[model samples]
Target: MKRALPILAVLVVLLAAIAVANPFFLEPAGFLAFLKRAAPLVILAAGQYFVIVSGEFDLSVGSLVTAEVVIAARLIDGDESATWPVIALLIVIGLLVGLVNGVVTTKLRVPSFIVTLGMLLILSGAVFLWTGGAPRGALSEGFRVFGRGGLGPVPWSVLILLAVGAAAIWLMRADFGKTLMATGDNERAAALSGVRVDRAKIFAFMLSGLAAAVAAILLGGFAGVSAQVGQGLEFSAITAVVLGGVVLGGGRGSVLAAMAGAFTLEALFTLLNLYGISGALEFTVQGVIIIAAVAAGAIRLPWKFTPRKGDAHAAS
Candidate 1:
C-alpha cells in the first residue's frame, strides 16, 4: 500500500479538480458515471500489471479485446438467450490466445515482446478478415446491462470493477505473487529457488487475457461494437501501469497502485476534456508519459559498478 501512495494522491487531486471544474461531479450519480467509464480500463490495467510485474508484456490484449467484442456481437446477434453462451466463448478465446502467446514465449524461447507483438498483428489481421472492415450484428439488451445498467443506485460496472480490484489485490498477496516477483527480479535465481518461473509467467499472460475479455464484454455493452473499440488500449494499459510506478522491467509495484494509476489517467483525460483539449492529444500525452515515467524510474535506480581484476588488486 505504501508503494501506491503517490498514485493514490494523484487520483484524489484529480478527482478534486474535477469536482471543482464541474460541481455535478460531486454528486453520486455523476461520480458513479465516471467510475463506469473508467472500469474497463482499470480492469485492463490490473491485468497488464500481472504481466508487467512478471517481467513480460502482453501487447495482444488490445487486439484480443477487439476480437472478443466483434466475435460477441456476431454470435450474440441480438439474441438475449445467447448472451451467456457467447460470453463463455469469448472468455475461452481470450484464454486460448494468452495460452498460445505464453507457450511461444516461455517454452519456445521466443522473447515475449516478439511473441505478443506477433499475436497482436495476427489477431488484428484476423479480425479485419472476419469482419470485412466493419463489424456486423448487435448486442442484446441483456448483454448491454452489465455496461449500461445499475442495481437501483449503483452501476454494475462499478460493482464489477470492485470485484476485479479486490481479486487482484488478493492475488498479489498470495504465494503466487511472491514467486512472480522473484521470477521477475531474477529469473535464474528464482528458478534455482525452485520456483516455476515459466509457469508463473504463462499464468500472468493468461490473467491479462482474462482481463481483456472482461473489458471487451463491458465495452461491447457501453460503447457498442466497433472494429476500433480496443484500439490503443494496450498502450493505455502500459502507461497506466507505469504511472502507478511499476517498473517496465518489473518485479516492483503494487496492484493497488496500478489500479489507482488507471483512475488517475481517466481523471486526467476527463479534466482535459473539460478544459476543451482535443482528444487527439491523448496519444501524445501517453507517449510523453511512457518516456518520462521510464526515465524517472531509471534515475531512481542506484548506480552500480563492479571493479576490474586489476583495479581490485590495486585496491587490495
Candidate 2:
C-alpha cells in the first residue's frame, strides 16, 4: 500500500494539470500520445532504477543512446537489408558497455559515479569523433517502425515500458533481486553472505546498459538520428528514479514506483509547457528536483521525532 502512494499522487497531479491546462488532454488519444512520448524516458528511468537501487550510478546511458543511434544510422545507411544486423550489433554494444561498467566498478573498487562519468565522456567524445558534429545517414524505414509504429491504437514504446516494468518487478522479487537489494543495503554483509557482490554489481550495470540501448532504439525511431538526440538523458533518468522515492544510497523503493516517477516527471513537464514555462528551464527544474528529493528524504527521519520537554531530567 505504501508503494502505491507515489503513483497515485503522480496520477492525480497528471490528470488535474492536464485537464486544467487543456481539456483535450483528458481524451484517450491525447493521454496515449503523452504516454508514447514519455515512453523512452520512462524506460530509461526503469533502467536507472536498477543501477540506483543497487547503490550505483549509470551516467553513460545518455551518450550510449546517442552512440547507438548514430552508429545505427551510419551502419544501416538507409539499407533496409542492414536493419536487423545493425540492431543486433547495437544490443551487443550496449551489453558490452554494461559489462565493462560492472567489471570496472566491482573489480577495481572505483566508485560507479566516477566510472560512469568517465564512460559518459568517452561515449560523447566517440560520438563527436564518429559524426564530426553533424550526424550522418538516416534511420531505415524498418528501424523507424518501432518508434512511430503501433499495434492498433497502442504504441509499441508504451507496450515495451509496461513489459519492462513488469520484468523489473519480477526481477526485484527473484533471488538475484533480493541479493541485489541486500548488496545495496550493506555491501560488506552481502559479500560475507556469499552474494558474489562483484557479479551482482556487474549484472546491474549490464541491465542499465541494456535499458539504455532499448531506449536508444525507441528514441532513434521517434526523434530521428542526431548528434544531440540523447543529451542529458542520464540525469533525467536519475531524477525520475529519485522522484519515485528510491533512496539515493539504495535499499529502498520498488521498481514500479521508480517507473511511476518517470511518468510523473513527464506529466510535470507537460504541465510546465502548458503554463508557458521555457523548456530551457528544464535543467533548473531537474536541479531543484534532485536537491529537494534528497533533502526531503534526509529530513523525513527527523520529522517523526519531536523533542520531549525535560526528557533528560525524567530519565535521571
Candidate 3:
C-alpha cells in the first residue's frame, strides 16, 4: 500500500486538473462514465502487473484483445444466444495463447520479450489475413451490455473492474502470489527453495491472457468491433503499471497501484483532450512513459540482477 501512494497522489492531482478543465467531471455520472472508459485498460494493467511481477513481459495482450474481439464478432454474428458461448471461447483462446507463450519462453529457453513479441506478430498477422484489412460481423446487444449498460447509477464495466481488482489483490496474498514475488526477486534462490519458477510464470502469463480476454469483451462492447480496437493497448497497460511504480524486471509493486495508474493515465488523456491535444499522440505518450518508468526502475535497483535460467544454461 505504501508504494502505491505516489501514483494515487498523481491520480488525485490529475483528477483535480480534469475537474478544473471540465466542471462536469465533478458530477457522479461524468465520473462513472470515465470509470467505464478506463475499465478495460485498468483490467489490462492488473494482468500485466502479474506477469511483470513474476519477472516476465506480455506484449501479446493488445493483439490478444484485438483477436478476441474480432473472433467474437465473427462467431456471435449478432446472435444473442451465441454471446455467452463466444465469451467462453474467447477466455479459452486467451488462456491457450498465454500457455503457448509461457511454454515457448520456458521450454524453448527463449526470452519472454521475444516470445510475446512473436505472439503479437502472429496474432496480428492472423487477424489481418482473416479479416483482409477490415473486420466484419456484429455484436449482440447482450454482448454489448457489459460495456455500455449499467445497474441503476453504476456501470457493469465498473462492477467488473471492481471484481477483477478484488480477485487480483486476493491472488497476490495467496501462496502462489508470495512465491511469484519471491521468484521475481531472485529466481535461482526461489528455485533452490523448492519453488516451481517455471510453473509460476506460466500461471502469470495465463492470468494476463485472461485479463486480455475480459478486456476484449468490454472493449468490443464499448468501442465496437474493429481491426484496430486494441491498438497500442499493450503499451498502455505497461505504461500504467510502470507509472504505478512497478519494476519492469518484476519483483515489486501492488495491483491496486497499477489500477490507480490506469486511472491517472486516463485522467491525463482527458486533460489533454480538454486542451485540444491530438489523440494521435497517445502512442507517443505511452512510449515516453514506458521508457521513463523502466529507466527509473533501473536507477532504483542500480546493482541488482539475477541471471535468468536461459542465461545460466548458456553460460554452462
Q: Write one digit per residue (lDDT tens) for candidate 3, span 239-315.
A: 89988888778788888898898888888788888887678886577567657755765575535463544666678
TM-score of each: 0.92, 0.91, 0.91
**Cα-lDDT of candidate 3:** 0.90
Instruction: Kindly list the per-residue Cα lDDT of model 1 for residues 1-316, writing each as its tens digit.
Output: 8878767887898899999999999999999999999999999999999999988998999999999999999989998999999989988998888889889989999988999999999999998898898899999898899999999999899999999999999999999999998888778989999999999999999999999999999999999999999998998898898889887777888999999889988998898888776878876775676577557655654442433224556887
As a TM-score, model 2 comes out at: 0.91
Worst 10 residues of 1 by lDDT: 301-310
lDDT score of residue 197 within candidate 3: 94
- The positional error of residue 23 in candidate 2, measured at the CA in angstroms, is 1.8
RMSD of each: 3.9, 4.3, 4.3
* lDDT by residue for model 2 (169-236), tens: 89988998898888887788889989998888899899899999989999999999988889989988
Query: How accurate locally, in lDDT, is each candidate?
Result: 0.89, 0.85, 0.90
Q: Sorted by TM-score, highest first, which candidate order results?
A: 1, 2, 3
